[model samples]
Target: MGDLLGVAVLGAGHMGADHIRRLGHVVSGARVAAVADPDVERAKEAVAGLSGVSVHTDPSAALDAPGVAAVLVASPGPAHEEALLACFARGLPVLCEKPMVPDSAGALRVVEAEARLGRRLAQIGFMRRYDAGYRRLKALLDGGSLGRPLILHCTHRNVSSPGHFTSAMLINSSVSHEIDAARWLLGQELTAVRVLRPRSSSGAPEGLVDPQFVLFETERGALVDVEVFVNCGFGYQVRCEAVGEAGSARIGDEHTMVVTTGGRAAQEVAQDYLVRFADAYDREVQAWVDATRRGRVTGPGVWDGYAASVVAEAGVRSLETGHRVAVDLAPRPDAG
Candidate 1:
């Protein structure tokens, strides 16, 4: 490995573009060596001011580009499996964005493939695990200070939904973060899921379900629930409160600067996730780069990604059928 990690980033979309900037400027010991997007122009734009960076429309071509020592799969969920398998074939470390693969079956394939290799290479992008607040919560639970968490109340809200957003996406894409967080925080696998749909918001697009209530049952008998509202017409907010036998703790209060004016005081709200979780994202990538440089893998592994997919699939089924759905996961392989 060189002194600096050379990464080939796939997909120059919103998340991909931000990651490009992060690898270039924010994170140390790494550089953007290559970038790939179906739109060649976008790929070029993502790497515009970077020296010696290559841009390609084909993802595999970028992976094979010179100086590409590692890979960052920031493409849409559907494209993750192929990119991941390619990285495995090349024996390169990778940081793949969430959902790993959107379907449980495909996600399982990725898991099994890595297990077959008998080592870990892919780290799923569950940046919440790296967040300061979430990390402290995890520490509290792990240290037994929480005294057996009983329930977790989570809320996820976005100012608006993208045009291509769908009802199922509310569970799979939006709440998937919560799905993984609940698992990581509690250190338990979700056993069942149920989703309840409330009336659509008037501000929401026609034929879209803006707000959803998802319930999850853990293997250890803890309960987790998330209220997801993608078209709240306000700001992005993610909050979690874990209730345990001893006490309860909450995070994501957004205790930013408060202004007192006109006989009122109000705190600032972040309009997007990039602003809200900026430090978390930076820490996540830095950790990945540091671990990869040391010839090791850390953070959420392929199994966690697969489990999130299985639970999310169950959540989507619950959403569609309006009934509780059981989650069934494949046995863990010994190697990965």
Candidate 2:
């Protein structure tokens, strides 16, 4: 316990609880020092087995809890801005889940806030960068083995969305991962976006955009396309294929488990993001903990988070207007 990095986790819902589990059981060198959620019982339940842990209904209290050396923000998107500001004011190193803030303007505020501090304290949770397959893909792209990459074919699907999922979420929430991945993989900024909505799947909720095809134009003249279908009703899958001038590489198929029986063969697909990206999340949190203990911040920083918000906002606009929308981003702060 004395050697462990004590982390205060904000929000005890799905992502938060999973992180707490990792900190307590899976990840080494970290301890759940405190947890906060609007539902006090949920927070308590998340840390039930941990020793010397505090649970609170208000995130501020958890931030102020004794022995807290850092923070992890897994709160709802709408609550992220305030939680992040609090972390910055306290100088707590943070690993915040994506969207950073749901709005581009709010995300920029975060970027600027960290800039004002003259150092990075928050690491936005774009976990794909830590995934084994993604790391390899990044290396392949960086090694120049694939030559000058020209197009990225990406797919994001889900069994189904929650009842409260919105059409805008298809771009902002589901495709935001791809937005960051494309930027990281291509090592360039996305300049514009266009979205095409197809006929809704019968399985999708009424008025919800189930399957949307998105096209992005990168600054370096590369193109990226995403087929985001949140109501596939089959499995949750994320795949990417990068085509360069000389060759192409693909990933996200490593999760398959094959079974052969009754004169048939089948491949099992993950039904949840948690199941599919489990190892990535573990590595992401572990990296954050390792860096925080060394008195530094690492991984995707505030700028990347802000860029994703800007691009996603542009995608949402394209979805609405049925026209290509340019990503108009504010100047990056000097801290970047």
Candidate 3:
């Protein structure tokens, strides 16, 4: 194993910059060797105080840069397909931010390439899998404490995204995490999808899409529900609950001890996804870097990415048709 894994991060925007900062200051067994962004100032800002890291105005430069053995791809959703293919062709392991790719086909290309490589060279950035609460939840489910999960309930709310976000954005950006988490937690693949749009909230501007609901069912008959409310004035939040015949497990609010009064009630919520899953992200990157050095990736592999994309696309379709959409997954040769 290499003494140190050289990490390059693509995109210097919001999420990308945060990844650069964490990889530089927080993650061990790896160091940020390069950062890429179209905006020179953003690139510079991303690496401003990080010592020994080079900045590039072009993503290709960082991708092609020497000594970069692995990459954390935080680029725009549409840019992921090509950027990830480049990394795969170079045989560099990648930890990519999710919804994998914008569409199923684009995501499948990366999945097929990794399958062709016959190794796990890609890890999807689904930090919830590493969350302490979710980890405990999964352990309980896996140990049969929750025998045969029958239903799952999940909710996600973001304080806001830039105003450019639209109604369709709910599926792609917010609810997709629930899609992946439901699959991971239940150990099942979604086989059907449904989307419901209840009453619109007044907090959302006219024509400013927000407050959408999504429902899905896995092949194992596990039903899942997700509620996404972007303009709800709440901090970034996520909740998961799994019910089974024997027992149930759930991810409770981080502020479970909230105090309420007769006239006022309030509970703390993370300001954004970063703070909500900060520890998960740190541990995820550290684990990926350490595994990359050993030529392996142990969590949220390419399959997870592809599956998330598939579910997201299906959710979009369901939203359009207002019907329950059936899902079909290609059999994985390696899935036992």
Candidate 4:
């Protein structure tokens, strides 16, 4: 126990609880020292079988718990800014799940705060960058064998949305992954966004938009288009294809099994993101733990989080107005 990194996990909802399990079981060299959630029972339930773990209703209390050397923030989007600032202030390395903050202004505040500290202590959760397929595709693009990337076609789908989901969430929440993925894959910032709604799906909740088509313009003259459907009613799917001058490559078609015995081809589709990206999440957390124990922080930083917020904000505006919205970003802080 003394050799393992002590992690304080904030939020014990779906994502946080799963991460606690990951830290204890899946990921090596890390132990869950503390857990915090507004619902104390949920937090206690998440750590029910764990030993030497303290559960708290307050995140700060969890952070201050004995043996807590780092933090993993799986908290809600609105609570991210404060949690991240708290980590920065305490000089603890943290891995914060995305949106970083819900709004652009708050996201930028996180970036500025980290910049003032003169060192990076927070890693934004953009786990796609750790996926095996996305990593291969990133390597292929970086190798330059395919020439300059011209376009990216992406698809993001979910079985259904939660009851509290709103129409704006279609852009900021659903498409935020693509917003970050495109920027990382292209090595350029998103310059603009355009959104289109093609009638609400009957499967969706009342007055909520289900499927949306989003177009993102990159600063390096590449275009990324996304078809996001949160109420697809079929399965959770995320696919990306990069087209360059000489060739192209695709990924995210994780077929579980094939049944060709009946004279037709069929494969399984994942119904939840937890099942689809489980390995990626494992790799992401393991990497963070490894780096944090070595006195470093890596992966997506506050600038990437802030950039995604700005682009997502633009996408929301475009969704409302049915027009192309230009992305306006503030000056990038030195991400040291």
Ranking by lDDT: 1, 2, 4, 3
lDDT of 2 by residue, 1-336 (tens): 888998999999999999999999999889999999999888888998889999999899999999998999999999999999999999999999998999989999999899999999999999999999999999999999999999999999999999999999999999999999999999999999999989999999999988999999999999999999999999999999999999999998883789999999999999999999999999999888988999989999999999999999999999999999999889988996
Model 2 has an lDDT value of: 0.94
TM per candidate comes to: 0.98, 0.99, 0.93, 0.98
Off by over 4 Å in 1: none
* Model 1, span 24-66: residue lDDT tens: 9899999999999999988888888898898998999999999
**What total of clashing residue pairs does each candidate reach?**
0, 0, 0, 0
Note the residue pairs that clash in candidate 2: none
Question: Which of 1 and 4 is the better model by lDDT?
Answer: 1
Give the local distance difference test score of model 4.
0.93
Instruction: Report the number of the highest-lDDT candidate.
Output: 1
Local accuracy of candidate 4 as per-residue lDDT tens digits, 1-336: 999999999999999999999998999999999999989888888998899999999999999999999999999999999999999989999999998999999999999999999998999999999999999999999999879999999999999999999989988888898888988888999999999898989999999977889998888899999999999999999999999999999998757988887688889899998899899999999999999999999999999999999999999999899999999999887663
RMSD from true fold, candidate 1: 1.2
**TM-score, ranked from best to worst:** 2, 1, 4, 3
Q: Least accurate stretch of 10 residues (summed lDDT) in model 2? A: 249-258
Which residue segments of model 2 deviate by more than 4 Å? none
Model 3 bad stretches (over 4 Å): 256-267, 333-336
Alpha-carbon lDDT, every model: 0.94, 0.94, 0.83, 0.93
lDDT of 3 at 236: 80
